[model samples]
Target: MKFQVRCFNIILLVLLLILIYFFFYHLRYIDDDGEPIGTVYITETRGRLDKSILTDYVKDKEDEYFSAANISVPILVWWTPFTYDTGSYTRCNNNNQARCFISNIRKYRDNKQFSAFLFYGTSFRLYDLPLPRHDHEQWSLIHEESPKNNYAFSFESIMNMFNHTATFKRHSDLPLTTQWLASIDDLLDQTYLIDVKEKTQLQTTENLAPIIYIQSDCSTPSDRDLYVKELMKYIQVDSYGGCLHNKDLPENLRNPVETMEHDEILKLVSKYKFTLAFENAICTDYITEKFWRPLKVGTVPIVYGSDQFQDFLPDNHSAISMLDFTTPELLARFIHELNVNDTMYDSYRHFKLYQIISNDTLLARTMSERKWGIHNDRVRGNFIHQFECLVCERIHKTRQDPTIKYQAKFDDYGCPPPTTFDKNGEKLERSGNWYRSYEFTRCQLEVFHELLDQKNYSFTEKDINNAATKRFAPSFRRNEFLR
Candidate 1:
């Protein structure tokens, strides 16, 4: 009887072990999304994203499983920076899910050992030797300034995060550079819109001053100071901050430009009719917050630097272009007229009524000549959050299939040479009209008229006479201009 009881207990134990094995196997191999399940081992040579941040990102994104029958489980494996020994794969080998390794070519010379390798652009230099494309799949990722920082890697695929069209190539034969473009054109989309009744109250508030310019960068490649100085001669531009401090800023607002809070700066700017929005460098599609801020605060932006200003603007009347007028005097005259005429000035504010569009839609429309539907599905957050999330998603997709390959050549993805100038400081034409093309001017006017017609704003002679009664305030005018 004792021998029979002992045999029964051993059989029960064996059955329990079999049940545990089947449970894990079924969970791993289950097909929910029709995608494969596999682990993506990412080992960074130079640390970019913090380990904690990467861990959190992966955990959040783990819901997206890999699609393949062989890949039963999807996992993201990362090596602790500085803690792991680079020469040995003992740590990686221990994990069954460790499929690929991303490391610097210079640091890790043994390319044949790893299943995959990823080369980061910021750390890459032209002098660095080419990474050998052995059995492993090789990929390049770049988000740095191009042309100046060129790479000679014969990558199977390249991922670019720049503000130009994906097909825009400096050289014809250059390989494909995929677009992961970044821009602040979605600022208005993120803002909560006021009701139609409340919008009238917001619009009725008068702009007390003519123009305001707050800049700390006195020296720049574009030499924006010369243009500002010339415009000041004709119009009363209240110069604040370190660049040109003609007027005393409030005691609370006397801090360094960088340290100043966004709300405080916007409060000061909202009092003015116009704001000088000039960029430091004149690069293609390289617009910054200097252009966006004024539009957000209901002030007309007198934009400079970017020749393709229309691309960024909601419409032609959204902002006054420095390139539109031949000289500073002409631009100043236009601003002065707008300041004196209330009806004309109010016309510029028509963009507030229309829904703000995203940069993606704008680019699509410009490239395809057809009106692309507004991008309502854009991820709303800070640039870093959106950018890192995209990178993580792409990495997962690439790791799922080792057969995927992309070609990104140096000349095609590189930045064009800086604009050449003549002896008189005038921009010289190289291949075509570099400044403002005729097509751009025509498009700007057409967009302005279209928006104007939508609003149905027609000013009669009587309306103009009534608007003339309310002139700009004396305090807002410069002491010399008032005299």
Candidate 2:
């Protein structure tokens, strides 16, 4: 009787373990109408924050079991530009940065390690090659069968609609209307503004100092040592702000640039009158945090971007002056004139305070919306078009070439390609076994317009005017926002 009871207990334990395993592995979801929901096996964590948990799931022996929903919300993954230039896999390996920056898209596109990049951020240089192909039209696999009983889960809506070059429609759809003006105001409220009187009370009047700020770091891909050397000619040796370079500095330089924590940097900005704001590259409207930090800190931002700085400023807002003169003698002379002329100096300050004080509410709203994984409003609808092009190319090529196989490589990214012309002036064909590098640039725009026009998503002159009035105006050339 005792032996029979022990055997019964062991069998029950094994059954309970099996039930728990199935429960955690399954993904359950509802349709847009909110009726019946069903379950499918989800191999990876779609929305969880734990990096290790997702890593373990992906490392499983059977990669086939891990399936994901076809919710093609224009997926965005951001990383510091340094990752691509050098193998900084140490920092990348810590937080699944490798997957986010590089591998995730490769996995999604069903290629071992190749992705179709439509729009990348400021730093990474682009390669001029046709997109690569994978064996599977993995995009269609998700749509072929619904994971749940009642609802049809299709990536068509997400991939087909969002992700365009002209607009970041994947992010938000708040019409660039007068009503959206409040978003920028809300952003300023959350800005870290140190009370002036309180800061003064902490420091001695004797120890009071000037500030010099640096924007980009020394290790960045676009590091400019010569630009910093030229800037030193204008500002006093004692004043500088922002993140300072770690490279060697001259001995005579009395005060080095500040290297504060991000929060501490904001706190220090409010206490100083002058903040050094330089662009990493010339003639690019790629404005960084340097544009706003000074305004929030109540300091005069010594601007160092492009000649078009005025385009980004609000109408009649002062508190900014450009680095106009080229020669050090001319620059030094102008700096002296601005400092002594009290009335002229005061005029620039008029628009400076309101940029931060008045627009507090709007600034807060903008920041909150940018916080990741909040609302899926389908801001733009071009990402899906690009994915569809890739999907079709993959399927079409497989039917043509039977022996094609996927190979992981880094050759396509960092270096520029050799000259396109062959000895006879015709373009050279790729040497790969499969035509993975098949060109498809001609028909993409036509397909995009067809889908958008079908959905009645037309942008009129009124839409352009409304967008310009609220947010910055769209510049076809710069691709950066200018007000």
Candidate 3:
């Protein structure tokens, strides 16, 4: 009886161990959406303050921040912009530097041996990723540009892959929100704003078209050219640049490249009553020079991009929303009405004309919240170097105490699905390989998880593509986006 009882206890112990393994290794692997975002290890701590001021803390007290004991010299790897530029990566040139930087993956083929991997969001292709992402090594996202890789990074499910971010999204660990503006002063500057009389005079004398749209990249995700072409039928537009060219730039500004560099571009654009400030891609806080140039030059912007664009506006009337109008013809009709009514048109420049921003939130955020500077900025340091330092310092902290870990939330890097309109221009289809790369990318994670368990699994681009194509793409429904 004693022998039988001992054997029964041993059997119970074995069953419990199996249950725990299945629960954690198999079941807990799923994210909230029930999708496996692949293998993960996270080692970074979020400061208990807003804006994750730990980045600013290290930057502010550099010497003091480095003196902590048992902090490992973490090697920070930049997976893209493969060239090592002068930007500070770890402790530069010091033998006991806080971190090291590398591009040659073969040198450290044991992928997770490094402490952190930073990916340049714009250039980092979905097809080409540093796979077998280990939770022990923190991942950092350095993308302040548009969602050109919407095929990969758009969905919230992908955010589970990274632990740090320096993007235009306000919720990012280090927000590069004001990338387009020269400074906060640029947004609030009234120094160059033309008065009502001057705008009227320029419109009459310069033969200024009601709206000016000068663009070089004709093909855009927004399909802006189609809208502009349709708008032209309803209103008189002086379209120049490469796309929809109906007018020539001034003799000196003939070279579009040179015109971009010329200070006169602002002066010339300001003469127009409105500027079509269409963006290349639509994503949150993806505002670029297209939006800023007009606002600064005193031209009312007909803006298209960013579903939450109004958050960046100085006032409700500061710019026209392309989304507001059902069709191009209707938008043109409103523009015509605004042109005739100087009171209505000039109201758009209220913030600029007065140099008084009623929107306190814009002032508060730009003045206080943002950590990175714009335009190779000298004071706050460029965002790239700052982001590298952020990864380095956080890795050190996490190494010293592994309990201090933080994961980037969905909002940190999430973008919506990219879609292209059909021939009817009414329906939207997903943008990707046969409009299916997004689906393929999600499926690729399963591949990553399987490959991750293997020792030193280095995937060729061809290997990844074939596996994802064969396993996933065929299952996707054709011509229709996955709902």
Candidate 4:
């Protein structure tokens, strides 16, 4: 009887502990640091989080908003942007997207929850610089432009909506002015390139050595092709594997078609002499992961980006470039000679091994920094905080709005009705109704909230729920090739 009693007590204790653990773990609440913040949550569905590029984006965004333990409002991100109702941040045509944003705000003014909104994109300069900001008004608007070059600027048309003021300046402007504002540093995935395991699995002597590679997509222009062709001519395609241009191929040149599932490309790099690392456009800081993939697989990279490469890369790396060799024939001859001479060939491999070893410390440090403490401060000033505070303020105000109808049938469902045309009182169905409507998951709505909250924009859950349903449906004109 005593033993039974003890067992019952033990089981009760275990269950109690579990209950306590979950209760605390599931609770989401705000801290009191007063930083304006938001979070963008990428969906883990489709096993998409495994890819480095997408993972880096999500990590960078989270770190940007939630850093410094600064308790502010939280905003969640959804992966598929098309499904969510952007609320006031709708994407109209490329030139008219900003106008669409303005129009959305006007349409939803009666609903106090959606007074502010935030939208991020790469092409800020093209949207016509110098956005509007109001002074010391709660009904004011705020906009943030994140340029592709790892930097952003904030303008507050509504100054009262911000806890702290954000200043705007140009890239080429004075150092003092630029320094006064916060610097938007990139949350780099420092472990982007690591690991150097050599593979011994060899099937054939011809396929033994990996070939140098360059893949040009279908969208590349003729001028881009000319540049690639010129580089390929210099790299000596005959000696290396082959230069790949999916669309246009010369008769003498054999097409280099790679299998999608085959790590053959990576394997080619590992066993090959060197991989060509040419940029699609020079002077652009968008460092494609192509440069690091070869290095991660224990292969040498011949790089050709801007001087910014030096800004981001380590010094004294032995990677060759278009600037290094005098001519294509000379480069080809050198590569051929290295292929025949085992000593010279092995020396190149040793250089690659040394490169990997040299960057090991940096790689580990970057990974740890990303994992902890890096996102400890919020950089968007107090805009999000103020907006969230204002939202709470509005919610209190609306509770007393005697004229406000809380229970109104909103167009929440995303499904659109068929369009009809009338001629002489006869209704006719509009042509081209085959296109489907867009769908949104719960995760997307959370992200849209954060993005708008960053702009000090507020909208109701109903408004957000409605906006999440618009899909990216474009109709081609009869003259267009697609049509």
Candidate 5:
């Protein structure tokens, strides 16, 4: 009887202890059962909370925000370009997603829960993050520019931090594959079409060179100037602009940076038969106006940029590619042959003059299928506004159903490191590559961790300098990439 009584007391004590553990664990997580989604009591583990996150969190929240899985409206805050909304930001359909947009990060009169924090990848820096991440909040990336903007984005751990992305890759949450070109017509412009007969006459008279090579920024990752220098050995190249300037521009057009969009420059360049469309960095889907401008003004482009550049053009024969030749000499020989042969030259222009394209060209179909405009017609608004709606709709969908995961992958914005050429024709690492990228990121990530640990997003440049006095991690110290 004594043994039975002792067993009953032991079982009762076990039950009491189990109940006590759960009661304190429940207190650890401040529930928002009757408050706005972001409103919560701070946990002691995350260190001292940002006082602002506590005060302004649920400042203007309505009763509808309380205790609901499906948020009718989720606010998205832009991390960069604070205290402003202009251009495309003004034009949005709120009725569609029933969502809100906040240009500033902290202050909002209509303070709904901030479901996603958007970062413009080019403008975003290591010190520019919005910190003290909430359990319910997610991160979104709004950058369509090249990975040259921030090389650290190439790292898998950094990219996975973004829950969604509006990037150039076709698979991103919002694919802005060719946002630079407003429409298909941008590719089909024949405004400056010069007859082959006049073109050849101009070349012979030394009035217009056979090819035009204009680039201001020199010593680039592609080493464009180096290739152009080698190509000049065989062909007649009228080099203008800042790098390898062998000719003079008209007085007004001398400033290469400012003269980029001038009408006079376009008219002058159109007279040339071929344009050197060399990109600063070669990347996938990184085609810019360099390739587009030559095509726009009815000049043949010698494309030396993206590997899959033909996939974005009118036809396979639309442009002369650097990929076909072993060296610059071989490529220049092909150019010289085409320059002398009128029939061959005219053949390249046939598709443009006829206004007909092959069925396989994805350029037209992709442009027509896009939901947003390039500020060309304003039919559906610009890409910036469309990206906002994408975030808004995602927030609503994810809250409505928990199974949908918001994720952005490395391929969405990852760019391979830039390669430089030595005098020996061997590939060398430039400071813009993994060496600098890894070391710089190590320092930046230290500050990032400090920001998260202390809940201080406003860590200044001075703070970063002080914190990063110790450079290079022990794990990465022996790695050649960080050397």
Candidate 6:
């Protein structure tokens, strides 16, 4: 009886040892709920809070896709100066001691487990600190809103947060690119086309006496002052802003910066037949609110910035392009004709029928269709939220594929200087004397002679093109393209 009892005790001891081994194995390799785990560390930089908010947002997004069978969740931890000492900060249940561990940035720098390093373009100067050596498996995040020439980074991919599409520059050599442009979704919802149509019909019937221009910038690289002055000759233009102050607005509306924010500006614009929508500087795909506001208010926008303005319009007739005419006089004449002819004017408002879609919808459709390779469509979005979501998604994708790598040469992509095109849709050389050098092309000379004929001023095209350099008063330069 004593021998049998000792044998039973030994058998129980063996079973206890087996249980101990299995428990330790599971503790080391498995997460809560016995699922395998992966972790990604985001750096704590100037935009750390925004990044954290985005991380939580992505978590909420993931929860929407969660399933009962698959409880896998990627651990997103913050890597700050404190993280270097205490490791990473992760939430832990009071009962699960084995599942919690402090993560350190220094340890992770040498360890290949960290997923990505997000670098904001504006904070590029802070990169002197120690960071992980360039790793093929990890992602390097860089985003820029403007081509400010101050950006410095060695990135594998780029997120362009400009107000234009990723294909705005059309550089084939650019690295893997993502776009996060300005979102007009909220703005579109606030605007009502029904009221705009009513206002437009009333104005057409009443025949407003003067066109309106609200400009504040007295100086600009785009020669807007000269163009506006020349346009004023063919028709009366009531200048409201500081550039050519013929009329003073109320004290509350005197500041362009403040007035532009409210709908009061659009309200004032709706009373007019046309509004000048000229950009301060001509950049590829750099259309801003100046162009969009007039359209929202049912006033025809005389646009003069991006050569690709037609692409953003709901229809070709939605806005008039400054490039369509050879001279400002011709454009002015066209606007006059449209103002007098109500039917012709009403045709421009046809786009009011279709409601504008959010930037998110446009982007998803563009990506699904793989249409980023072409400039066929306008791309805009809620720049902040969409950009953060995109970054998070890319990081998750890289975690799944450890072999992924990207490296783009900086010279392969850039914002080149804007190109000048004549009315015939041909590029022109920037260098040469203005009216006096006969450097103008045959097409330009023909347009010049036609303008002169309209004014009943006879001048041989060859003589005018090759006329000697002559100085004119600043006012004359503003009121006339050539004198």
TM-score for each model: 0.49, 0.41, 0.74, 0.40, 0.75, 0.50
Q: Rank the candidates by lDDT, best first.
A: 5, 3, 6, 1, 2, 4
Question: Which predicted model would earn the best lDDT?
Answer: 5
Clashes of each: 7, 39, 5, 31, 0, 4
Q: Write the per-residue lDDT of candidate 6 for residues 1-483, one digit (tens) a residue.
A: 999999999999999999998876445444345543333333312223334433443354333232222323332222332212222223222223212223322233333334434333444322232332343333233333333322222121222211111122323222122232222342244353444345556555754444778898765545476677777777778788998778777788887765674667766776776788887656455565677777766677889876666656645677888888877778878887887676787777765545444234433333343322211233422222232333344445556675543443433233333333344323344411232122222223344435444753444434443431222223234544332
Better of 1 and 6 by lDDT: 6
Collision pairs in model 3: 40-135, 41-134, 41-135, 41-136, 42-135
Measured by TM-score, the strongest candidate is 5
Model 2: what TM-score?
0.41
In model 4, the Cα lDDT at residue 375 comes to 18
Q: Encode model 4's per-residue lDDT on 231-343: one tens digit a residue.
A: 45544431332334323323333343333113544454555556666544333232354555555555556665433343333324545554465544555566667555656
TM-score, ranked from best to worst: 5, 3, 6, 1, 2, 4
Candidate 5 Cα outliers beyond 4 Å, as residue runs = 1-72, 86-95, 108-112, 255-258, 375-377, 424-483
Error of 2 at 191 (Å): 9.0
lDDT of 2 by residue, 134-253 (tens): 233222211111011101111122233222221121122221111112234422443554444443443356243333454434322122334445545555523332244433323433
The lDDT for every candidate, in the order shown, is: 0.45, 0.34, 0.67, 0.34, 0.68, 0.47
lDDT of 3 by residue, 1-483 (tens): 999999999999999999997776654334223443222221111112232222332344335322221222455666654323212223422425455443322223243335777887766665566665565877788777776544456656567778899888888887776776656677776655776677778778887788999898876666677677878888998888889998887788877645653678888787888999888777788787788888887889999877777777777668998878877778989999998888998889888877766546553466566665665566665666677777777777787788998788888767665555433333255653323545677677666556655744677667767787877856765535454
lDDT of 1 by residue, 130-238 (tens): 3223333333333323322222211212223111112223221211111212233433432432332332333346323477888877755455676677777777778
TM-score, cand. 5: 0.75
lDDT of 4: 0.34
For model 5, how does the per-residue alpha-carbon lDDT over 144-197 read when each residue is reduced to its tens digit? 766656666766667878898888776678878777677676556677777888
- Tell me how candidate 1 scores on lDDT: 0.45
